[model samples]
Target: MVDADQTFVIVGGGLAGAKAAETLRAEGFNGRVILIGDEREHPYERPPLSKGYLLGKEERDSVFVHEAAWYAQHDVELHRGQTVTAIDRGARTVRLGDGTLIAYDKLLLATGAEPRRLDIPGTDLAGVHHLRRLAHSERLRHELKQLGRDNGHLVIAGAGWIGLEVASAARGYGAEVTIVEADPTPLHRVLGPELGQLFADLHTDHGVRFHFGARLTEIVGQDGMVLAVRTDDGEEHPAHAVLIAIGAAPRTALAENSGLALVDRADGGGVAVDESLRTSDPDIYAAGDIAAVHHPLFHTRLRVEHWANALNGGPAAARAMLGQRVSYDRVPYFFTDQYDLGMEYSGWAPPGSYDQVVVRGDTGKREFIAFWLKEGRVLAGMNVNVWDVTEPIQNLIRARTAVDTEALADPSVPLESLT
Candidate 1:
């Protein structure tokens, strides 16, 4: 239980930080609750940046985690647009960018992840965009609208979720788009070749050109404005705008500077935390994208960058901080939307860990429930264009039950029956 006089400080203003602040209040931590963020805006969700928000279907107000007045009403101090520069573990305080020190009885670091930047020439040119924050997406959205009706070509580097989603949006805006990826198949590292191929085919059907197994050597530009992207094979693809969406890296500088244990960079660098979300210092906890937590089910330490983990991990960390019996054991989950296809996936299995995939429904028709299994036990499940079955799919993975392959691939056999 938290003492009445203790102050709880939450660093980072992203989803995880905001959720942790809410959890602390909900759990009756009445002491000073300060939520600090480097950005001017309050906590907001990021999924819509590449989808509805970019397309102007969603308003700016909808992205915020809470209204401006909510914080004042809840007695939570809102410190925005200020950076937390250092952590003094012995003093139990953090120094802000402006050199103001704030004491804390407990600290939660949810610094989140930042987009990995491209180091190629012409990257600093105008019209070259990277979508991680609302500002980036807003700029890209405006440029896409200005380049209306196939008037300009948009060249995108990397074929990950952000790249593919941006491709879908660009196509919707009637812009000619081309994607450059070093991998032969996009998303192959995460979804495996077969399923990854499905996404490649999906984009191909919608008239999006792909340069597979090709590396981007330079961004060709004129007068500080992007004109095209040049690949290693000497192929120059024309473009008026460019987006770099390779991936993201965790913001672990605060953890590293404070001498906190961090996971190896090769294995996804982030602050290391146990199943309880506690760092080397028990009073400090790391959650969300900044936490490399041990997953009990997979028997491995994994860092997840999805919204689900941030949403659930916050409360779990708060409860654990309060000395409650808790464990952050929720299965890893994520989803993506492209064109007319939507998918929801549960469970986390590294590539080559699963022996086989048993798929139900029809892949050709773009509707299916694919289950990845190892030693006849379900490890992960994904439902594509299939509704009302996510719970059952997740249940199948959580139970870790040995399943009949035939029944798993049969449309008539309910997934719940397997568990």
Candidate 2:
């Protein structure tokens, strides 16, 4: 049933779009593949933008999904620096920013997410930054290096993953850092207070300052350059630069304009898709950060913005577009590396979902695995400085069976046995 003349168009050139195109060829589909992206750079993974690449541990080329020649050799029509302005679902064609229209037999909207901008004034000042794109990382890297050499100070507006990671990187470069958050602790929404304190302590030990229970009200600047930031608590901190790491918002404008079904903002806004990653329009599909998939295993709609989701979701969407059945039920997974601590989290455990948290190893030594359990069933797991346990951890979550609390908290007990 693979039609050689059929054309498949992919909008967005991030990991999801690039991998989908790769999967199409790998799955023996010789159809026309057209990929469009606004960014001039080739498709690349995003994790490095906050981790290795920002810290100067990775080369620029290492972040790319594929070599520059790979697309040409694979017969993929790569359209870098091109934006798909409008998607006409009825016409089965997409209008580019330059007024070009491309027809497609099947379409995939992998058009990821964008960083949420600070609503306060002085955000347009020259020393204010956001870390979402490779260009942003590159500029920040240079700024951090210069600041490190001059003993400059960086004021971060949020204590989220991006903020903490950038704070770690800035500290590594010997730049002074101060993070301000409205929550009581860092990662309050994701890890909760029980483990959020651990990250706060880790960063504090590395000389990173924390201003909790407050939010940035304005960025004070002079001559279009940031000089300091003022908190709602009437506190002003001297800053050579400011980073807005609040969060990201899914780019769902094109989908909305095309009348595609979207999840309500209250339930985590995104393009609504079934387990197959197919949208309300059968010929159109959504993937990556933009797709709020109705997970078959969890029996709920979930939108994962991490790199793992994009990595696997792309290929799954590709297979589904090829007339193959695909149920994307991969557990939500993400990792972080800050200072000397590295950790991986698996599964979903939002605030009211879990009743208790259990730890398997030593917390004082910064080596432990925390499990959130609801009614004795594992809802999520996080291993800090723990190795080679993702498989068993994911298996435990997938099983959805009640696990003994004592055994779950015992390091000597094998996790595989519990599952």
lDDT by candidate, in order shown: 0.90, 0.95
Candidate 2: which pairs clash?
A: none
Return the lDDT, model 2, position 318: 97
Candidate 1 has a TM-score of 0.98
Cα shift from native, residue 125, model 2 (Å)? 0.9
Give residue 266's lDDT in candidate 1 (0 to 100): 93
Q: What is the RMSD of candidate 1? A: 1.0
Model 1, 9-110: lDDT tens digits are: 999898888888888889988899899999998888898899889877899899888898989999999899999999999999999999999999989999
Q: How many steric clashes does model 1 contain? A: 0
Off by over 4 Å in 2: none
lDDT by residue (tens digit), candidate 2, 1-419 = 68999999999999999999999999999989999999999999999999999999999999999999999999999999998999888889999999999999999999999999888989999989999999999999999998999999999999999999999999999999999999999999999999999999999999999999999999999988889999999999999999999999999999999999999988989999999999999999999999999998788999999999999999999999999999999999999999989999999998888999999999999999999999999989999999899999999999999999999999999999998
Please state every model's RMSD to the true fold in angstroms. 1.0, 0.7
- The per-prediction tally of clashing pairs is 0, 0
Top of the candidates by lDDT: 2
Among the numbered candidates, top TM-score falls to: 2
